[model samples]
Target: MAEPVADQNSALPDSPPDGQGEATEPTNANREAAKYRTKLREAEAKLEATEKRVNALLRAQVESLAAKELSVASDIFDIGGASIDDLTDPEGNVMSDAVDAAVKALLAKRPGLRNGSAPWGDVGGGRRGSIPDAPPTMLEALKFTRR
Candidate 1:
C-alpha cells in the first residue's frame, strides 16, 4: 500500500503563507463593535425619552402654579374694580395703572416681586397695543343671511 499522504488540512510547519487560518479577527471585532453601537443608540434614545417626560411634568407644574396665582390676583384686584382683561391695554387703562402700581408697591415692600416686569402688558406691540376693528353692525353682519 502507498504511504498515507499527510492530511493537507492539518497545521504544518511548512504550510504556505496563503494557506494560513482564516482572518476572522477583523470580522469578529466588527461584529462586536456593531453590537456596542446598537446598545449605545438604545441607551441614548431612552435618555431622551426620560428628559422629554421630565420637561413635560415641569411645564405642567409651572402652568398650574401660574393659573393659581392669576386666580388669586384676580380676586384681590376685583375689590378695586380692576379686572385682568382691563389691565392689558397699550396706553394703560385705569385698571392697568392700578395693577402696575400695586405690583411696584409689592416689589418695594417684598423685594422678591422685582424679578421682572409684571406679566401685565400689551408689550412688544404684537397684540397688546393694537385695537381690534369694530365688528359690523347687526344689519351688516346679517347681509349674507338675506341672500
Candidate 2:
C-alpha cells in the first residue's frame, strides 16, 4: 500500500456520526376527514339531480316531436278537404292508420306534391254539362230552306 498523503489525516471527520431524525406527523389529518366525506356526498347529490333533469328534458322533447307529427298529419288531412276531427272515432282521437291512408292517397294522386312540386292542371274539356246550349242565329232561320 502507498504511504498516506500529507494533508489526508486533516480531512477525516472529527465528530461522532448523527442518527436519522423522527418523521413529522401532519397536524390536522383526522380533523379534515369529515369535511372531505361531506364534500363527496354533495357531489353525488348534484350528479343525481342533473341525471333526473336530463331524463325529464328527454321526455319533453319526445312529446314535442309527437305533437309536431300529429300537426303534420292534420295538415295532410286538410289538403284532401277533410278535417282530422271529422275522421276521429267516438273516443275523440284520430286513428293513425286513417292519417296514413289519407296521406298515401294524396301522395299517389299528386306524386309531385311530395317532391316540392305542383301537380299538373287539367285543360278545359269543352263546355260543362251544367250549362245549356245557345239558341240558333236569326240569319240561319230565314236563309236555310233545304231539309
Best candidate (score: TM-score): 1
- For residue 90, model 2's alpha carbon misses the true position, in angstroms, by 42
lDDT of 2: 0.55
Clashes of 2: 0
Off by over 4 Å in 1: 1-22, 71-147
* lDDT for predicted candidate 1 compared with the true structure: 0.54
Per-model lDDT: 0.54, 0.55
For each of the candidates, give the backbone clash count.
1, 0
TM-score of each candidate structure, all chains considered together: 0.36, 0.29
Candidate 2 lDDT over 23-139, as tens digits, reads 222335545877899899999999999978865554344333323333343345446554535445666455556555665666677554453333456677676566546776887
* C-alpha lDDT (0 to 100) for residue 120 of candidate 1: 69
